[model samples]
Target: MTETPTATKEKPAHRSGLAAATREFVLIVVGALIVSSILRAFVGQMFIIPSESMQNTLLVGDRVVVEKLTDVERGDVVVFEDPGGWLGQEESGQKRGSVGRFFEVVGLLPDSSHGHLIKRLIGMPGDKVACCDAKGRLMVNGKPLDETSYLYPGDAPSAMDFQVTVPAGHVFVMGDHRSESGDSRVHLSDTGPNGGSPGDAAFVPLDKVTGRAILVVWPANRFDKLEIPDTFKDVPAAAAPPPDKPSISLTPPPK
Candidate 1:
């Protein structure tokens, strides 16, 4: 009867409920950030193409999706850390703001457009990679590659002529726009012959590879899949060195 006697304070209970909800929201946000960070560190991340090194394949300002789940393969477009002096003088000084850095750490922003280089995997460990033949084509493992499908509109396979067997645990890379790219070709300290490939900073170490660029996600017009062209399908395996470490053939084993 004294029923509505003393009205218990409803404010405290409502305040407690709001506080609990806020905590849950915060935790969810934090947990999401953590998952994104882990994925970026070990699974996949976004990278912004800073230069036209990749050209029509990847233009300036294009956002590329680099995945770390699979092994690097020949014909795969890859993004890697600067092996040494690969970056130009202007690239060394680029930096992101604190806000951008935070986003980068959480996988919301692209990797620093500076420290990474993207190129096609032209040679695998111990594979011989060389320039144009009589028909003006690139050669891999003694077979010719008709690169017309991916090469920039007017770019040649390569203006320079050289051959190098990729050293063990290293890979040889080049840009689609051969003329504009300062790839492994220009960085060679010495050439490789008879399986004696010069590795002195000429090749990119396996550990230095960030991941393969599999997709272009931004600038809707440029949206596309970065796939191994049909040319690689016909590429034969590289012959392993006799009495030496065997090199892995990048082409798929014949079924």
Candidate 2:
């Protein structure tokens, strides 16, 4: 031991501090990633407006926060999975390669390119929805919807005429820009896989709805909370059909 002690090699204080700082930084990043993932998966998610379907209300390039736990109600704007190839050849602005998709899933990027559609819930299951009831207002279960508050200025409630009873377990949806939107009304006659009838493919299944859009988060100037217009407030519950009538057909004859 008295002999010359072997030279002790110790890490410099600065080096040790650098290592600790690097580890802390990495941990913080990972923790943030986990929290974001949880929020995006269970609580809420961000979506980008890909088309002009919901003009004035939701313009293309607008970013919105979709609340997953909220109930989907009539007049609520919602994002949903495309039902039965309804979004034919529609390109998602955020469509990316594998690596890009991974980032989107991890909540690192905006979910603008996903294969989903956005629209206002117009009719609940079992509601008879019809277009242009004399005053050009949409009628649901005999009650007219005064859509002027949300309908794009100068745009009619619908350009084409249609009347269909929303089947159970599904919803009838339409965009604010009815003229430009390819919504439930457009697909009323498209037969689904089961091939039941013309109106069978028009409704979006309840399960397909992702979430209700609660806020617009992008384009700072456009920041605002989406609210249910007063028009939806006055809609009375659908009237029950008489027992003697096996079926209820509220659709008026086409001109």
Candidate 3:
């Protein structure tokens, strides 16, 4: 009897299309991750507070979101690149390192070669800003402000005095922690203890404004939209060459 023909079995063929689909899926995921990283690096970023210079408003260890949009108005909190040095930081480390400096050149870094700074917009180009009239209030274009809503409990409006007209294309900035912060007031060449060189007092260019800090996204309890203070409401639009009158000063009370 002839043996029955051996049954033959064929294995399923490998599909090339299936492999291509898998590869495409992997590429898409990788591309997305890269895009997100690039946005974080150049567009908007997050930062953690490393000092108390900003105090109650921005506590140490609090994370904050910084936008790269660069549009700002008065009374906005902002993040900008740091200059060559800041209070007590090592001179070398204070300068924008490779990553931050590189971004600055391309306009991704708003604070120049420095690193980054967060502060409030007080005086804009063509606006006059001064510290304390007889009542111990910051005056912007002859308008006294009511900052009780945001000022830390018991904190003075400003321990120091300053007076200056913001230059065209520049802004005057200050920290919410007036007594603790070394802001434009301390840097005015005419107002400092020595009357030598202004401390950190320098105008920030409008183009350098990165973006207004709209919300506090971290530290769950502090999360809220930063509002424009009513104090700045009556302040006049900054004008070039304030009308020949002294706007602010830092002189101590005579004994």
User: Can you give the TM-score per candidate against the true fold?
Assistant: 0.86, 0.89, 0.71
lDDT of 2 by residue, 130-214 (tens): 8767777788777788888899999988877777767777888999998878888887767765776565567888898989999
lDDT for residue 55 in candidate 3, whole number 0-100: 66
**What's model 1's overall lDDT?**
0.80
Q: How would you encode candidate 3's per-residue C-alpha lDDT over 17-89 as one tens digit per residue?
A: 6778889999987776677667765677666555566667777656676766656778877765543233445
Model 1 C-alpha lDDT per residue in residues 1-255, reported as the tens digit of each score: 466768665667788999999999999999999999999999999988888778889888888899999999999999998887688954332569999889998998888766888999998886877765677788988888988888988988877677667777888899998888988877775433323434456688889999999999999988999999999888787787421332323332222
Candidate with the greatest TM-score versus the true structure: 2
Please report how far candidate 3 places residue 65 from its true position, in Å: 1.9
User: Which stretches of candidate 3 lie above 4 Å from their native place?
Assistant: 1-22, 41-43, 90-114, 190-201, 241-255
Give, for candidate 2, the lowest lDDT window spanning 10 residues.
241-250
Q: What TM-score, to 2 decimals, does candidate 2 have?
A: 0.89
User: In terms of lDDT, which candidate is stronger, 1 or 3?
Assistant: 1
Error of 2 at 206 (Å): 1.3
Which TM-score value belongs to model 3?
A: 0.71
Q: What lDDT does each candidate get?
A: 0.80, 0.80, 0.64
